[model samples]
Target: MWKCLERVLCLNCAFAFAIILARTGASPVIVNGALGYSVSLSPLTSVSQGIDEVVWRRLSPRMKLARCSQGSVQYFNTNYTNRITLHYRNFSLEIHDLRKEDAAEYEVITATGNTGNEHSELFQLKVYGLVSGAHITVQGIFGICNLTLICTVTSGDPTFTWWRNGEALVNDSTQHIRVLGNMLEVHHAAEVKYAVYKCEASNPISKATAEIKLRDVCKLDTSDPLPNSSICAEFQATRSSAATGSF
Candidate 1:
């Protein structure tokens, strides 16, 4: 009978411990970090006096990052050696020289000695590359309808934004303008003859802008013969002009 009673007590204690853990759980907060940069994960609640220990951990592929107790800090995991800092006052964790592999879910647990209570906070880290080399490329004839200007970037996952005459452009069916992901299509090319168009590409870390002028791209050579001229003569004339200019 005593053995059965002891078993019942153990089961009750296990159930109570599960409830305590559930109450201390928290939703993960998203934190954005740039590659090769440093980012800090702050605790949701301030560390109070009489707290005995603070433990920082990475959840996935579980690893203990650091532990603090009695005004002393202990570092774990050779992967994070010399790259992490634990602030005593606030118990915030700072990771330096962030890498793509550093993106993961982190947890901070604080335990109070007197009360034997523990609280935990979670953070989800996301790393992004810097935006660079953004430029605009044109398609179709300059004077023709359905002209398209495409925004291209050399690196980074970026969002595209279009601007015309310094004003933000959006999808306006009335104006015959469409703003697709990285392409800006204008059904009426004449409407933009005197306007300057700009394409801005950006990510969480950086941004770049490129501009274009329709007049410059569509400039015509005044020296060229009229459209009515014979094709054979036009080719010969153009070759002769180029030969004379070489001198």
Candidate 2:
């Protein structure tokens, strides 16, 4: 809990400092990247006057990425060879085709020409991959008509959204629909008929989807007709346009 609070306080301080700079007409930028994408961490505005040199580093691990002094930019060690570049004028660092290992804290420090006072700003980069899978499964009550649909995945930090027949599925007070995390619970035979529940998972880079065709699972066989419930009729009439849905 203390670690969590520290992280929150650290982020809050970062944002507060950024806002202070923006208010003073010097707004630095934080860059977020994804796997296989290129990123550049540059200041949106110029640094303070009398600044003569700049240095960049991975602030947390204290790894030097680049240095800019006397109008020249220098890359550090071989760990960043061929994949990192530094801009001499502003000391911005360019990362080519980002990877998970590249995620870390970064900072740019400015050296004053005469005032002897140094200023610095921070930039933190986070890299993530596209969401994968979203495999859905039906659990229990194959004959009783009550069920739960579970959505799963293999990788990536993802946010999930639930859909029913292409419409957003929210909690229904009648106990017919219930959504929690990646699970969707259904009760009543009418709720099980003529519906399709879709689970969409997404990360910074891309989206993936999976679905449960209620008509297929609810009915015993393809030859069997749909239930004659009013709710089922309504769902059938409002068919979803998810013909090409894929995982």
Model 1 residue runs over 4 Å out of place are 1-25, 171-175, 216-247
TM-score of 2: 0.66
RMSD of each: 12.7, 11.4
The whole-model C-alpha lDDT of candidate 1 against the native structure comes to 0.73
Look at candidate 1 and give me any clashing residue pairs: none
At residue 94, give the lDDT of candidate 2. 84
Q: On residues 1-247, what C-alpha lDDT tens digit does candidate 1 reach at each position?
A: 9999999999989977875774455578888887777889998657655678999999998999999998899999999999999887789999988889999999988888887767778889988776777777766543245568788877677898888778889877347679997899866544344557788887766777777755532343435553431221111000000110001
Models 1 onward score TM values of: 0.74, 0.66
Model 1: how far is 154 from its true place, Å? 2.9
The total number of steric clashes, by the backbone 3 Å criterion, in model 1 comes to: 0
Q: How many residue pairs collide in each prediction?
A: 0, 0
Best by lDDT: 1
